[model samples]
Target: MAYNVLSVIPARKGSKGIPRKNLRQLGEDPLVAHAIKKSKKSNWIDHVALTTDSQEIAQIGRQYGVDTIIDRPTRLATDEIPLAPVIEHAFEEVDHEFHYVLCFQPTAPLVSVDSIDEGIEAGIDSNADSVVFVRDSTHIYWRDGENGYEPVASDRKNRQQMDEIYQEIGIFLSENHIVRQGRRVGDSSEFYEVGMYEGIDIDTYADWILAESQLQRKQVLYRLIGNGNAGTGHVYRGITIADRLFEHDVLFAVEATEDLAIEKLEESNYDYQIFENEPSFLDYVRSTQPDVVANDILDTSAEYIKSLKEYTSRVVNFEDLGAGTDHADAVINALYEHSNPPENHYFGFKYFCLRNEFRYADPRTAIPSVERIMISFGGTDENNLTAKTLRALSDLDHELHLDVVLGLGYTDQGSLDSVTATYPPNISVEINQNVQSMAEHMEQADLLITSNGRTLYEAGSLNVPVISIAQNHREQKHPYAHISRGVLFLGQAEYVTEENVRTAVEEYVTEREKRETMREALEGHDITNGVERIKQIMFNQNNAD
Candidate 1:
């Protein structure tokens, strides 16, 4: 427990999504600022440091008092560079002994300070090789091509029969878990279930849009995506999709911004460009013009894209920029589209759904349990619902676990803190950001009291009985869509009242048979193997020619 924890934030100059992503602003601060700030604030973290080759990113780290900047070499910054080696190289540079090495990406701007503390505590208390923070995604899977996505018996077996499945939410806590460490899967690593947003990363422009839009909840750029805030969502979503797609080289076109989201991208060290004007954007494309340019149009002007499309063979308008039906050859939707289609058409959620390869827990083993009420309203929740929901949950008569998700871009952490301090004995508050599989956590819960958005879809997919809360004007419009389809929507006709929220939970909780029915409906959702499906689409398209 008394060991030094070295926090390394890897950032490189070369990027494709938005130029200088690491140094880029996510709301008012840079992307790396979130992780660096969170690391600095964490009670368990001894020292917050950074690993980067970019002087700008290093300077920003310095601005935040993050002095440990490990200069990553060009060799390790390559597109083919595996993260393990990059992390190993940095740890090798450290001369002192450390208890835990927490590696976080600036992209995951919404990482919760409490979750970091929890992971560190778990790592020490469990006496495990590594206590990595992860969110369990039960509905997610990948096909081996044989099972065809049929639910694995291990997944469908009784709750007692299932094994917990965890993914390395880019944010990792390494406790000397390598080959030399001695133990399978990196020194008997244990998984910590953080909130859903923490699992987000930027892999493709579409994924980037999904992460940002989901958190902002307002149409900033496109109806699907939103203002550039946290870089983690963009980074995680992009990586997930790129990992799925086989042959396409994902390029990110980011405009210059003063937000932390951009810095996170720079830290990612992907092939990217920073555009200041239309001419520069066009020049960027013509210079290293990739086969396809996945535009992360956070603030990118239309003229730039219009011109680039003329010169480039294919410009896939990732739905990052407000509806681009008029601009590109193809549009990538992480939630709606699954497979590649003919020209003039695009893909969405279907493409990004969970793959079968990730199904670690059998459904049979999954117990019919509901304990916590998950409240996730992206970073910078334009609507301050975190405190409101906590107040409502505190009023509930039955024991309820309050799972609260905080975003780096969230401006109301102070308010959230105030709520946590006043919470009743039955209410438990968890401040989290980037987590692994969010679906698995949803699966464990009985009633989900959240806004009608991405998390709702995730809950629906997992058969987690949901009580949708309309936190904002946009949410108010269709609070009951999920409920009409069998998921409960709570805020229609008025902002979700505390009494109404409690009533909805009671209604869902008391009826065991109704909960079972909801679970069955969740079973019908097409299994999402976002990774494998993307792999098939990209590989097939890449090999088609």
Candidate 2:
């Protein structure tokens, strides 16, 4: 049996909490317009009837393309008058007969079209006289003065374990006859559960503000400070995470010295601003007033984090171990692993933000012998480790190909040029190559020589046996690059001589068993899901307050 559903949007001019609340602008449209749009888009709604006392509201309803405009009398528009009379007045105005009346309050703009259709279907299927839109209010309860505070139900179970308690979210579906009698529900009534986000009801000024904020997209400021001294790992990590958060408006904030970081942001077509100093950066952040600030500048100072917290509601730091980490709402240290980190600090390989190319690429199968070797030491080899590794590989007596991957920030082109000129027929260098091809190179190569940085995790995901050389003492502490994880961590680059690289390369090349074992061990780690895990943590932290 088909039911003719009449969607009634009641918008009164007078509001005690917020004057003209229904007509007030919410984002691009007015509060009442939201309900009008939802009703018009609904598949179950046969006709939309907007009830209002004010002529201005009637004009607005006509502009919104409502089929019937019910001019509610001043007597029935009083605050003391209930919603049932106003709905009944609307039913008397419309010519077409409707089986059910969907009372969609203008104050509850968050109501979705799907919920309207679903509620109607549920009410029809259950053969109920009325249906109401509800949200799970399991833990919430009222208290009596004499009895003090007590659980609403006898069973004081966990919120998830407790029986679902739903509260009406201002959307009511009632039989046309019951509504005509000034009653929202008869004896039989059912309910449709809408998501918490969609069940938001706007009544007061605070509620309107909250509803408006929910409707608008959040501004996510990514503070990524990377330079020649500090490799481009932070920049890449910031971009990777920002790319995943398509729902939010992402903006990159970098230092002037971070040219490579700026270039990457530009290449990705992301909005960004370069700050000359800390003061300027802080000023910019203050001016923007971002909802959330994701700091990817390694260690953050207490004062810096405090200043950021002053403007932004949520502050997230990436790979931060400084005094500021304690102040940040969430800290993600994916490169370094700590035995017992703070509750906010999410450490280890589980939070490693891998690039889409590496995360989606299939892990390379271990070959019988090391035929082709790939060398990658992050975006900026500040220590000139690339040349050092190249020099070391020059001494290799074995007849095997060496593919040298140069970073964008690798300034010492003279050293690289000299190495290429003198490079034996076996060695070849590819400078400033596309990052997307990095995964392909990792797949083709039998062995990888890289710094103990972000690339280590990427290589591990690819199941490539790696000889990790630490750029500094900090990189050496990375647990993922440890020997236990199958990475032959050749100490700091400053101490690593040409002989050390030659010897390590030769050992890995000759020893097939060791390479295969290392490949198996690296593949055991779940690094592909790190982006999603970190996203969840950030989302939780953003909503923690």
Tell me, by lDDT, which candidate is best: 2
> Which regions of candidate 2 fall more than 4 Å away from where they truly are?
1-217, 420-436, 541-545
Off by over 4 Å in 1: 1-232, 245-248, 258-260, 266-269, 277-279, 298-304, 320-323, 334-343, 346-348, 353-367, 433-443, 470-486, 491-494, 530-545
lDDT of 1 by residue, 1-545 (tens): 35578787777777777667777776567878888998899897776667787888888988988747788888988768767777777777766567678888777776678888888788788877776666665553455657466555434555445676665667777776451243213647888888776666665566556555544431111111223353244544554454444333455555566354455556656455556755676676677655555554433455656876666665554433354445665554443332455455444434443422234433322325556767776656666666666666666656668776665567667777876787678667777765555655555566666665556556655656566666555456442344334477655425566677666667666676777776676566554554465443332354211
Q: Which residue pairs in candidate 2 collide?
A: none
RMSD of 2: 17.5
Q: Pick by TM-score: which candidate is best? A: 2
User: Using Cα atoms with residue i matched to residue i, what is each candidate's TM-score against the true structure?
Assistant: 0.49, 0.63
Q: Write the per-residue lDDT of candidate 2 for residues 1-545, one digit (tens) a residue.
A: 35399999899988888888888888788888889999999888889999988888888888889998888889989989999988998888888889999999987788778887888899988989999889887784656747797756766677788778787888899998899789987789987899886888876778877777677667888889766667677888888888798667788888788877887788888899888888998898889798888888888899999999998888988988799988999998888777888887888888898988787687877578767889888666768888888888876666677777777656677887888788676655565544656887887788889898888888888888889898888887887776445689889888888889889888888888888888899868888888888777776644221
Worst 10 residues of 2 by lDDT: 536-545
